[model samples]
Target chain A: MKKLYSTKYFKNKNNKHAEASLKKRLRFKKNKKKRNKIQNARTKPQKRVVNNKNKHFDYFKSKAPGNFSFLTHPIEVIEFISTLKSHFDKKRKVFILMNKIKSIDYSAIVILLSIMVKFKEKKVEFNGDFPSDDNINNILIASGFFQTLFKISFKTRERYNIGTHNAIHTHAWKDVDAELGANIMDNVSKMILGHKVIYKGLQRSLVELMQNSFNHATPTKEGEKHWWLSVNVNEKQKIASFSFIDYGVGIFESLNSKKEGSKFFNWKILMNLFSSENNADVLRKILNGDLHKTVTGKHYRGKGLPGIKEAMDRNLISNLHIITNNVFANVGLDKYELLPNNFEGTFVYFEINAQTSSTPWTELQ
Target chain B: MDRITVKIARDFSRTPGPRYIKEGKWSGEQFRTEKFYSIFDDAIKNDKIVVVDLDGTLGYGTSFLEEIFGGLIREHHLDYNQILNHLELISNEEPYLMTDIFAYLKDAHEESLVDNH
Candidate 1:
């Protein structure tokens, strides 16, 4: 009976299966050929406008240099850096064109710091020129990137004031086209290549912390707009630093309403609420479920600090020091060291490793 | 021998949504709760290769994972170091696990694979 079945049903079934497989294979082959043609067509030189209207709008819309306009939000900043990564081929000179920028906010500055750090980590050369103005310089200084992140010469400042500012003031800016158009790409290329990935995690953490300030700490007036930022990178040392500052109402005033009736509104209580292990764990538990709900209601998802703690544990980041409302929490060696300090709003600094040569943790361990 | 696979499970049920008050009382919608873990557990039992994409599967908080994976690890009596090593391996490949509890599941899966081997 088995032999008879095999001779009759099995042979017919096998033939049918073979025919179906052959048809499927032929279809796949045709699709593969079409796909190849499409892919090759994509590689052909395509006419792309170097200066489209939308690109022009993007160029003039905001301040800062490079693609800082891409750093409006923290998530956007992260996505931008992740995408910019593909541009780092490590062969050709990479340029971050920031000539069209006018001014920048602190949030944009911190995002820039993260990008610089990531670039340094990848060992890719970064080159760019940004507006050299007093306000821009002051914003950079306040964000903690003036001396810590980049080297700016006083002569360059004087030149900018005399050449750029005076040019705008006296309508002579158009006269020094040669000076303005000097080979900045080379200097930028060298600077970015030599740039170190320092204070990247700190910058990211500070951005988040500062945004939290805007969200829950600072009070917004009818039409008042404020910005905050920081950036630093040390490619060789694999260290980075970042900080942010906002001009809005500080933490004390923001939490003053809660302080009016509760004992948990004092600086010490606030610090504990922000850094205590129990509170952090509880917040972590709540955040583990759903972020949207945790962020929307009064039951605030207080996991930012805890998330920072977890990041420190997982990443190459070494330390996180936060100073808010005269209270401080310094996390190092997987422990929290609380201290009293005199400061306003929020300030955070952290250290991270940024060596492209080193094996990633997953691959190494 | 079947290739070892890791699976991730989420509890979308406990994920709170916009709250509503029915008759001036707080109530929740028919949110997906047990389906995530049930799918994962069923997949594991059936011995189908599983690779839990943490970022794709879970987001935000990880308490649900702490309970699920933590319980699995405890039940299996997996070596802590070995579990962590496996977790580090998966996390390095997919950093999303660093923010979610899927890392714990990866760790548990490694231990189970070692035991089976």
Candidate 2:
């Protein structure tokens, strides 16, 4: 009877001890899991993608500066590209935050619009913010930024021509064909310049410009090579100015690449030439067709620049200025000056004065 | 002397704007220059006069003109004057085109003689 009572008491005591030990082990496991999760959260790289598949892109994070009036602040244009490229490396849905833009200019609007087109070309989903400043917004819209975004046709109250909307807007080109070139020229002549005639040489020069972009722009992807063209008309001033921008390998760099491709020059000796002449001087030679004798070895080479010069010389275009790389060439003044910072590609701006032309737009068909 | 006329619109390309050679389209570097050269070369071999009509077509590119007119000198080894003698250019719509082609041919002649290659 005594042995049975003692065995029951010990069994009850053992069961209580076993239960406490099981709870202690479960508590330790829970604490370890919590610690592991907190440590993982601390060490892990922030998720680039969110649930909505949209990535948060900060403008200033890449440390690249945005440009305003890219002509005056050319380096900022390049810097802006660098920033955009860094974000592009992520390859997620990009939300371009332009609210951090420290400076803004009309030319900058053209460049941003071109980038947007690039994103569209790649099928990369993206949207951007307008500057918080009301003045900048007004300037961009007045300069035809939104109209271009919507792909508004180029015409006016005068002509109901399909694809002819009377506005200063951004445009892109791929080939040197007549359909695009002729239509663009007609719009510039009738709607902008108030001329009834399309200047054939000027139209041809535009094609050549696109050709240069194709031949030398040298983008990462072949189709990614794009040129941005904006034509603004000042009717009261009787002047029209055209801006063309291409983001690609610059002229000098392209010449160097071509030289290397042809195996024409010994880099050891050519390195000395780089020290002596800056890109601006090289640009002058290209415009004058002198680069043909030195580098390209082909007669047809350098013909495009001369073609554009011919248009300028013939009074079809006037007061021409080309900024490419770190060089600026003012053909009218016969001046070539090196800029403070380099532009990775090309920016060409020129004015057409109505009074300078002996040929009346009305007389042209 | 049979005066052969190559109407760009009817014979070569109605909208010869692009210059893609590999695609075999009506580009300057593709159909236009190649066909124009063949006809001109054939006409010249038989001592026939050649007339090129530049109307009824979407204009021309500098490369197109240079390749056809200047290519005679650079690629075929014909002198600039010889091509001008054999081939006559007529453009009612763009009268200055003939002169421009002549200048391009002359420039190509002077540049090709240098033997830069």
Candidate 3:
């Protein structure tokens, strides 16, 4: 019975062999696909580091004085400036490349301004081709350098047409050039020496204010923070103005969120918060007759405003104006005063005395 | 029998500033204050040797420290020897030691004068 049951052992063996072959073919196909993927990856060309080096060297060589180039990173701009300083014999003829500059932090501005100031001190002929936009120009003016270095004048209707488009414009032996890739090496060299001390105090103050904007006012989501800063030097008055502006949530909104009562919304309450000893440590310090010591902690502790006040007092700057939420505060030699303005957001404007013939570094111990 | 009891208001060893603590080890300020106060309270309650070492633990302003310690000394009626003994154990600086000693002594002296009146 066993011998005669099916009578097809060879056929069954062939079927099993066929199935094994099919499985082997599938495994081979999968392995071949993986191998091809790895080979493709191996053959992919990486960007050559030597090509970048050549491009970087070529960039400085081709840079023109007082012209702007398409540089996104601050490090690149700084490197380009270093190259220019090494190559150029005349330090004064160099101008900044700022037209394509999309964003700048306080530290960068401080470094750039320090370079400009050093160039002027060395009797170098320097001019900057800043963005022609009013906001941009004003920012530069406010940065405390615009008034200290360059003589600014509005172009008349006829001269405006020619000067606006031209890469270089001359007025009274002063040449304001376009944003050409220029040799900023001399400026960069001088700046590297002086920028550290100058920027420390400046950045500390700006960072405090900027942090206030970030934490209190326009609270930005993880990646949505937007702000602008500009600096300009006035050659005639020997004054410099640094200005910063942000489009985030304003001071009023911040205060309003933390407010408990209707009375807290008033301007007087806001002013008191800015200049009061309400917190426990601050109150204790005030009671202990330590007005100069700033109260600091996790929720709120900043010597920032106090530091700014100290800096202003030390410098003996004549004009200090703080504008926010359509209210303007002016602190002068004689008195403190306030005025209303249509402009919104916070604006801090100070006239840095250029004729004093002293840089911030000179005052630092 | 005279027992020298020092009631410390805060644990000098445990309390750390905001900058010192990582987020994973983040203990809130309230928790830190409680730990400090509890350690000090326990030290004071026990009739053991109480040591107040403000070597690196003085994170808050001098006034805050004064308010806290001033109130503690007044409440406990801590003697000059007790305060000095604590100071000697902590640091040998004159200005800080003298200032704190004078503050406590001045208050004690003033209270004595008021009692006399």
Candidate 4:
């Protein structure tokens, strides 16, 4: 349905209009929020947490071998939290045993922090001796996990500075401002993309991830929900890697867990479709914005997941990968695998090749 | 024959987007629906033909545009056709933006008809 008279056809008319309208259009909305935020900033506000110094609880009596490498074992970390729930429900004192932790990774950090946040919300007294491995301990502390959760100020740490390196890590054990993705872009862009700014598509995708982690991913225990984000750079390889983990119901699990989930499948069955459907197909469909039909009865939801494919389709990002529940898929690697055991929650990682994506990203703006 | 204009980057945060953050924020968060619509309403009340400059800003979110443009119909209770008659967007940089905005208006139109969105 192309119109006979196009805007381009009326360029002269449009310019004449533009010239006349230039001075009339008010720049009204731009500074309103900034002014309000500044006005509020003038008043000193109290800390967001209520820390209990007197009560202390031991988390685990046994040596905790929990680390990223250990977490990759077939066991579900959410179930581990379930084992601690009855004990947590019975006592106010909770202590975690990290002394036995010989190895750890990003996934391990997310799981530990998420579990701790859940317990913290229960008003249980909690503390733990640092893992004996100095490297592991330093990584955890630099990640802003403890400070962000407990409201402690560690001014001596390099975490306060932005230019220290190309790596970014933040664990939100509690609710937080939308700072992680923006901060990651600010810190890593100079070294990686030659700019100190974030791409709009990536920012939207990141914000959606954070929002979903908090909004729908109910914790195994009612009080705990957390998300961990990390972006590491390989300068020689000229690539950056991002890892985001949230322990909640995975996308298919979330959608299918509802009654609509079964109804959609039943419809598929009647239509002689969905014979080979698994989490991989479901994951792909979700990312392509094709799952709208299943959700139309509920509401126009599921717009966020497809943004990854949209960003990739628009060449905003590459090497997009995800593992949620029992499926593993990487768009760049051309892999969409369904593994043997369900991964429980979701784990996502992607690469930003500096050479191919060095331009200042502006598609989002 | 002349149109009214609103230069977003000149008056708002150059990278206008969402309004989730509330404190110690340096960037302006004027991307809210109420904020944008109030300005729109003033122009509408004056019976002025308006052109919104969607250029110069860092980028626009689907949610941001949907909330403001679709919300003109949804929250402000303005008719979509009525708003379209008076409102024109300047998205010369991304012609596809006009399409996106119209899709939101269409969704809002459907919702207004049956409250289905």
Candidate 5:
């Protein structure tokens, strides 16, 4: 034979076994180091990079949609705000791109202000650019967003003659300010009614709202968190729109944690048996005085919501809408909708127009 | 029986605030301690009917109303029936507030009964 492992290698069975052993030895000799490297890699632990630079390395960038409004684009606006929760939680820098925003409504403006206030509270770093569109930028300035956030004052631009133009007045308080609330009501009354008239229902509603915020807005005892209020008077439409916001554990969350195993809990169970216990349904029951009736032992508690509802019923205010947690309710129309995103706070918006009645200043004292 | 009148807007606050004094200025608790309670005590001792004028204020919050009326029974331990007998609430601007005050008194009385038992 020419060689032991030649073309006739398979011709002899004994020779073939010897050839197979030789081939195995040659293959193991060629790749022996590669096998050792893989084994060593499996047993070694990787090092973690703990540089301070790496802590702030990653940024969560969020883009604003064109119509950022709870009234116009509710789902998108809510979802956009929800994205910042992570930025707050991780204490990461967030870059919000607002170049694409065409228009923003008062509701969205209030929400954005509220979010920035929270970001300041948490010491979370966030950055944003003004909308390239000058009109939208003017709106941001006029609504006091830029002044409140960056402390940069711009020459107040001529207001847009849009539907229901806003002359925005904003306020923030840590405790109940009945005087401030009354002053606001007085100003709003003069703006709409052309005279000073105390709207009793509206004043009561404001006090109740402030009390709720002071008492239940936070998990802390009381007065630790600030409640924000914005009033936008539209002299053209003769409608004064008010927005009240508090960043707290929302209504449902507050009740659930605070009233565990109480009569409110029993009522909640009964409510669940009768209907789906979605946030909207629970909110409807609360507004309807169903849940309030269950907590009668305290007697002073649980009247804020129903009292607001009663004000609406008596035609003291119109277009009463509330968004808290994951529910959006148009209480005036009896429409309670379950939103896909959570608001993380309570927002109450109502309007008082020319037709809205008031207690004349002359009628009292 | 003798009669006395306490106009809340005149004697207490024209802008009544929240429930407790710790909550804010001009709170119902402050009003009760500084103004209303003394007058009420005198009325009870002297067999006088107390008339409370509930108007001429910016408005009355539920907590303010509750703390004043309900607190008579809850805080001071005054009999609710006697309070109802002697107390006269005049709310001309907001008539429904009178109804609400009466209800709060009844609720506080019921709550006190449960607590005692």
Candidate 6:
């Protein structure tokens, strides 16, 4: 009886000890979890807040020149964007500063829009601040830049009195959207002529450019490539400037890239020649239709670019400038020069004025 | 012989698209397969002339035009000369288009000959 009592008492004492140790371990686990929560909070990245005051971030600054324009300051603009793209490739968060910019144009705005859209698609974090100058800020807002960035509608433009500025707005499309093309032409005609007339030349030019992007912009499948277009109309001057941009394999590289399901081989010989030349000579030859037959081996193909050239020649459009790859050509001045820095895509700017011809709209039969 | 007229804008699309249907809606290939091919076949079979009115549409891409007119010869195996004989184009909006169509037809014919040889 004595032995049984003593054994039972000792067993109860051991159970009590184990219970106290379990409680102590539970307390340790709770403290560790709380500590981990604090650690994770400290390590996590902060969310970007896009507000009017524009909060500062630990971001690399992509500085713009005083004159932020492709037309006036081609080298500076291209080099800035080229470096910006390199920054994007590195997945670095960027803050594009236009505060120093005194003057800007729609051409540069459209190109920047394309780059920003690409950055968004790639999920590379970027923020842009408007110029400190009120006029430049208003121009940026009127050009539809802030609207696109902020996901605001035309109401923003109304608030800013966008009509005071010549920039009609900027737009983009991912595929060959013909209906949109027609609608744009209709609006252009309405803006320029004060009536809806079918501007066939401009419509065709726009469609051809869109089609080119759809087909040749990316090595990927169709509908994957994107094109941006912007229009600036000076009503009193009776002139409308159109800018089209596509960041793709470009005109020169497009010829060499293997097309989807195409039986023909890549243009090895032409690519070699294209590499050696100043690229201006190559662009001139391309505009003249000399390389099309040789590269494509199809007489039916390569008419689109030449067709645009023809429209320009016929005075349907004027002051045409083409920048593709490294070559920038003021086609009207018959001047083609190689840029010190390369632009990896195509930028086409043209204008239509009172001198431009149009096809009168007929009642649908 | 019946004069079969195909008004592109009224019958097919006011905004004709790029070459292939895979590219977008209302594509030239779609037009060729869905609209123009049967008319072309009927014209060939019945000794009728097919008059294509090219006005009223926004415009034509070179690819769109080539895919339809040149595609008749290249894709349908129709002789270019025979197709031209039966085809008449009316492009009041852009007369230059008619010239472009002619060039495409000749080029397609030449390509076909090269393939055969």
lDDT by residue for model 2 (A118-195), tens: 654555555555555667666666765545444533221211111124555556655444555555556666644565
Model 5 segments more than 4 A misplaced: A1-59, A152-166, A259-267, A270-272, A295-302, A363-365
True contacts kept of each: 0.00, 0.14, 0.00, 0.06, 0.70, 0.62
Q: Give model 5's docking category.
A: acceptable
Over B4-93, each residue of candidate 2 has an lDDT whose tens digit, in order, gives 987776776544554455312456666535687777778878888789877655445566666667677777777666677788787876
> Model 6, stretches more than 4 Å misplaced?
A1-54, A151-167, A258-276, A294-302
Alpha-carbon local distance difference test for all models: 0.38, 0.62, 0.37, 0.56, 0.76, 0.77
Best by TM-score: 6
Best DockQ goes to which candidate? 5
Q: In candidate 6, which residue pairs get closer than 3 Å at backbone N, Cα or C atoms, i.e. clash?
A: none
| Candidate 5 lDDT, A277-341, residue by residue in tens | 67788788788787665454343233687888888888887899998988999888898998877
lDDT of 3 by residue, A316-348 (tens): 233554444433344434232222223233445
Query: Model 2 chain B — which ten-residue stretch has the worst lDDT?
Result: B16-25
**Model 5: per-residue lDDT, tens digit, B48-87?**
9999998799887888888988888888999887887789
> Which candidate should be chosen as best, given lDDT against the real structure?
6
**Could you report the Cα RMSD, in angstroms, for every candidate shown?**
30.7, 11.2, 25.1, 29.7, 13.3, 12.4
Docking class of 2: incorrect
DockQ of predictions, in order shown: 0.01, 0.14, 0.01, 0.05, 0.40, 0.38
Query: How many residue pairs clash per model?
Result: 25, 8, 40, 14, 0, 0
TM-score of predicted model 1? 0.31
Native contacts retained by model 6, as a fraction? 0.62
